[model samples]
Target: MRQTRFHGRVEGAAACCSVPGCSEPGEFRAPVTPSSFDGPGSFRWLCLDHVRQFNSAYNFFAGMTPDEIEAAQSPTAGWERQTRAFASNGGDPMPSWGDFSDPLDAISARFRPTAKRQAVERFSGAERHALGVLGLKDDTDLHSVRRRYSDLVRRYHPDRNGGDRRHEKKLGQVIEAWQTLKIARAFA
Candidate 1:
């Protein structure tokens, strides 16, 4: 007795090959139609030899074009449909920064030290802050402000600092303070 393969075969009762004029026990199942319209699909129970013959002659890409065949072979062929990244948005879902009110600008401004000047015995709030920024004495006047501005510019200028930018930001702050204090009513 030969050992029969019932791996995919129906249990309990063996089906006979559906080929015309044949009496072999059908041990394997094949699709009855290349493309099926029915549910679970119609299948033909074929014997070993017939199923082998059917598989050898089957043309999976029978009527497909060359491009269609190539696309079908690609690994990413149906990935877009599966991912559905553009299903709702029609493209990327991320909003461009230009489209929204920038939060970074607001956040940076919040963290930045406000330029509000403090009230001093003589100078106003603005003048006090400016003096602090320029490292000047509260007793300093317009002439002293000009002199200090020139001196700081000389000391911190990139050219004077041997092309180092370390003090450039400080130099800018000093210049701004001088501009503010020179025109101040106290200095006038």
Candidate 2:
């Protein structure tokens, strides 16, 4: 028995080119890959010449403004900003989004970077402690700090913690801590 080399379908809508009576087996897979944000994924069935023409005329960034184009084309800017290594606590810089014993408290504490009127007061100082907890040295490079921060943020993010409203505040605090540290560290 001979095995068929092509496992793809060549019948019905997938069978022929949409170009009138062209009876060639649609050789190319033209599935449109959509953005992860779920915009659109409509595939086109075209013959070689038509496919080439479509490719030539297609402008993926058609509707965007000049500013949008410029911004999107530029390297990500916020990654280089300072964080909290200058807190005078003598601890290492905090991981980007370090883990916490309580996520609800973390999220709630984000709003209070200053010293008063908040459950987790002195978040700037707490941020310094988080860096110490992560075991990063005060002199650690930005690259290492960001990498560790990303790791902890992913682990404790409230969104990924399965609908625990309690964790939401904590997650926010964790984020705030990282942001404070990142900005302070960047400038200092």
- Number of the top lDDT candidate: 1
Model 2 Cα lDDT, one tens digit per residue, 71-105: 76778845656886655555433333333345565
TM-scores, each model vs. reference: 0.38, 0.30
TM-score attained by model 1:
0.38
What tens digits encode model 1's per-residue C-alpha lDDT throughout 53-123?
A: 98899987999999999999999988757553446644333432332245574444444444542222456
Q: Which parts of model 1 are misplaced by more than 4 Å?
A: 1-7, 34-38, 82-188
lDDT of candidate model 2 versus the reference: 0.58
Extract clashing residue pairs from model 1: none
